[model samples]
Target: MTTENVDTLEFNPISAASRNGGYVALGTLGGKCVVLSNLSKNVVKLSPSDMKEMDLKTVCGADWCDDNYTYFHPKQEVMVFDLRRLATDIIRECQVKGVYVESYERKSGVWLMPDGGLAVNSRKLWRPDGTVLEHGIHAERIYSASGDIGFDLDTPAANDDEVQCVLNAFGGINWRNNLGAEMLLGWFGVAIASVAMRRRPHMLLTGAAGVGKSTALEMMKWLSGKLAYASTGPQTMAAFYQALAGTSRAVILDEFEADPSRRHSRDTLEIARMSYSLQEGDEGIVRGTPGGTARSYTFYSPFLAACINPAKFEPADVTRWVVLEAISRKPDAVALKEAEARVIGPRLARRFINRWANFQKNEAIVRKHIIDAGGDGRMADTVGVLLASYWTFVSALPATDSEAAKLVELLDIQDRIALHAITDEQRCLEAMMSKVLPFKFMDGIALVTRNLSIAEAIQRICDDPTGNLEITMRLAQLGMRVGCVQGTWRMFVANSPEHQELRKVFGGTKWASGGWSTVLRRLPGGTEGTQRIGAGFGAAKVTIFNMPADLLPANDGSALLAA
Candidate 1:
């Protein structure tokens, strides 16, 4: 606070015209109230306290500044020695500010300090008191007890009725289908994610159409303000990057378009990958004229996606989300969750956000314990974050409440279940079985049969599924090679003998697009570098395309040869 006022401080100009083009106020750097300026563009490294200093003069020194604060002139009009001090000062300042961090990527936004306190919003980014920069643009922000949001959300004062509403919403969510604890933890993560800038778990609430899946998401949106976009979210890669360039808020996808067998496009999958990359670096994109470059800053934030079926996303991408299920949803009562959201929601959110580091640390402990106790590696990261959020909520609960212990017990059970789910290969097996080998009893073993070609398989699936037929076909083809294959691969795309035998079925231009022998080449005998397509071919050539067949279940979820 030892800043000089503009009216009191005098600036001696070389002449009248150079009175003051402008003066930048520089503050304490490396714990000293010293100032340095040289057109350094790393503005995010500036601290919030430093950003408020008023007009200070910059002395361009060719050699060095005297201890007596004397300004010297250069012999020639060239870049000054002052450049070295400016660079050095910036490096020192960044070290003190933790900006050169390896663990935390951004120099701004919400940061969790090691002491378990939160450095939030402008405190982390060096913005003005009441503004937020999102998507490479600054936007007005209004903060409540719930912390910072991009827009205004009217939440009433904490009241008994609202508290009861929170408890009721917590109690009434259908947890019968083994989803009670995970759902509650997801709610806490959304609340905490409001002030968390790191890569956190995405929440995917799944249930039937009439269920209250969206109700919980709506409540989080109300808490999130303009920061939360409540549509199906960006389906294309460009749109997604545009919608979330610099936002650190909750982006909720209320009714995502999901297809279980669908594989994400390369660019689309990049979005999912970047969503949880949790590293420090720029995801570069070359834009502007040929000679110009602008940094399109990318970041990972919390996202919530809801739909009827949640099994569509690939195994890798699915691990990024904490899935919650609502079996019995009353559409009429959704507004009640919204109303209650306005009351105790912000208070509860503030509780976890203020101590985000504690929750994060606790999450690590829970994750290790779960994995050691035999949790799924796929579910390891997801369960850890969810359990940490749940424990944070429990700690925030009033000790006087009689039901607190019960809630704690339920949370413990939920934690155990999530951990145990990794070992429950039977469920993954059953779900996988439902796909390739639908539920059918044969003798005492379960198996599936088919003789469809690549075109026929694509037709059966794509004839009604959402995404473009071309992309769907392409993904299915990729899956046929990778998902269906076991061990190493050796087969080339297609061969002369295979095409000659399958000429009648895949002869014409329609089925002979990019990969005509996909079905015939992917059969069990595919990896031997050569495959026979049809039953006959005039002793040398045939007229049938690749054929699908019945199979036995291999323990690893791949199809086994039963021929």
Candidate 2:
């Protein structure tokens, strides 16, 4: 064709062409014919026929010949020539920078390569329009075909070695703030993990001040390589989502405080929830964007653990967490000193890695067991894949049934705490009540008298309680009517004739305040000066009345029952 005519020809290129339908034209350039293809509205020149002929000889490569063509040049690049021009142009151009072209055949769409001759036996090429031309048995194809042919190859063999490795890496023991108690309580965590794998499992750990929750989390970090710690509250859900999308493992959230000053916005939480279920590239702006953005964001690594102090959060936050109540007993000085002196962190990490490797070897069995225990079956594979690297740490440690039991217990406690924090007002009230009355009295009250529900009572206590008297008033409003009778304010059953029964159960006279004083009176030498009073005394004599029997149990049976 003449140059003017060639220039006049439209180069409107479709995204891709099919092998059976698309066309490419060759025009004379100098004395040689130059291959060209339409790219949307523009025409781009390809290699000259003479150059293609010369390069075909020197460019040693492997070519796969089938319905579709794939060419791989040794020490060069790879290219796929499909019958469809759209697919051919896009795939070729996109991968061209990374591959070297060698010999190609136009008619058969065959390519020759230096690496593996006739590699096309199991390859597939896709056109720009998303049509696939199967050349060889692809991994996905094999999986599909096997199912179609009733091969029944879906059963996964257990990797006992891998499971053992992971168990070892974790030191067979899972540590937490309340090591003894949490060991018994951590089963809820297992359940949660199982659930998360199926749906989206996210956990938040919170506990009282001075608890070693942070320390425990740090230990987990050493075990799980896919952990990331967050130190501040300004981090947006979007940022965290993006971070998680890149990793295939779990994340470790550390020092997360539910401080009102640092609380995440509602939008942030929504995004976070969305992120848990979103795969990479499946995430996009569902709203807010003008035309809506299609995000192909990558998947974030799952969070392995999260740790926070209970004091840092409000009661409203309990629902979102699996709390591990820290041990009230302070760590012994000698234990603290030893921990401080030794470089246990790195050792722990190494142990975890070794255990993970062992676990990976037995993954199938372990996963099956986990699934049987209510874990997500789909994530059975991931459990092994993700934990395989940290198994050594657990294997060498002293792991016992007791420890496992303890872990399950702790997990249960956390679940309870989370549920109470989220939905149950009585639990919140119990927590608040503990601060005012003895912890033992948390569930002792027959009725709570307060203007508001348990939630309101707790909130009021948290917000403004001038003194014990105000607390008494708030409690009275709920139901456990506390009033000044005989000049002493005391809790009493509202309009109940079972005053004697209440006294016997709670250990105090009808008018006496049944609390610390009554408890103290039962102690040795505590009730020496205490005086007993007859029933029906007015509010005046109630203060002087001391009925230790009201506080004392009738027998060990009653005490045990009360306990």
Please report, in order, the local distance difference test score of every candidate based on alpha carbons.
0.42, 0.32
**Local accuracy of candidate 1 as per-residue lDDT tens digits, 456-533:** 433332223332333233322322211223432222233343343223333332343324433343344533343332
Return the TM-score for each candidate structure. Answer: 0.50, 0.34
Q: lDDT of model 2 at residue 314?
A: 32
Alpha carbon deviation, residue 557, candidate 2 (Å): 33
Residue 267 Cα positional deviation in candidate 1, in Å, after optimal superposition: 6.8
Candidate 1 residue pairs in clash (backbone atoms < 3 Å): 212-329, 501-542, 502-544, 520-546, 537-541, 537-542
